[model samples]
Target: MRHLIPLLFLAACASTQDPPRGPSLPDTCGAGDYSYLVGQPARALERVLIMEELRIIRPQTMVTMDYRAGRINFKISDQDIITDVTCG
Candidate 1:
């Protein structure tokens, strides 16, 4: 009985599965359409994903890119204006 209990425990542990993941991000982030956001009020955007600098990225909310293909970052001014638009 003792051996069977340990074997069952081991089997249970080995059979456990990892939690399911959420939806995946798109291959292309589609940053080009946001050029109009530059020089506009920051609040004008319904979804403002702000980034202070390119080096500082939020993994849960952001992705790092080797080229300017699939990411758009907005630099907001203290006065709540969008000062810059960049792609990564």
Candidate 2:
């Protein structure tokens, strides 16, 4: 009976432990069907912020971040190609 009581207590403590969690992403942003945008001319896209490596100008109706989504964002290449498309 003594051993059983300790075992029950251990089981209860384990049950109260939180479950493991995985990495999470914002609900506002996600990888959508931007495949069609690939290979298309960058100019063909509607008004959106063009993201490149290291050049800056006045902010327009677009912005960039390591992770963000809520609007159309374009990841472009130096050659002016639409490399990736994401939605926030």
Whose TM-score is greatest here? 1
Query: How many pairs collide in each candidate, listed in order?
Result: 0, 2
Per-residue accuracy of model 1 over 1-88 as CA lDDT, tens digit each? 8779988978887746788898754435454556677777777666755432232232244554576544566667766777765555
By summed lDDT, the worst window of 10 consecutive residues in model 1 runs over 50-59
The residue pairs found clashing in candidate 1 are none
Best by lDDT: 1
Candidate 1: where is the Cα deviation over 4 Å? 1-29, 47-68
- List the global CA lDDT of all models: 0.58, 0.55
On residues 1-88, what C-alpha lDDT tens digit does candidate 2 reach at each position? 9789999988887766689788655434434544576776677566543443222212243554554355555667667777766553
Q: What's the distance in Å from true for residue 42, model 1?
A: 0.9
Instruction: Give me the runs in candidate 2 sitting further than 4 Å from their true place.
Output: 1-33, 46-68
RMSD of each: 13.0, 11.5
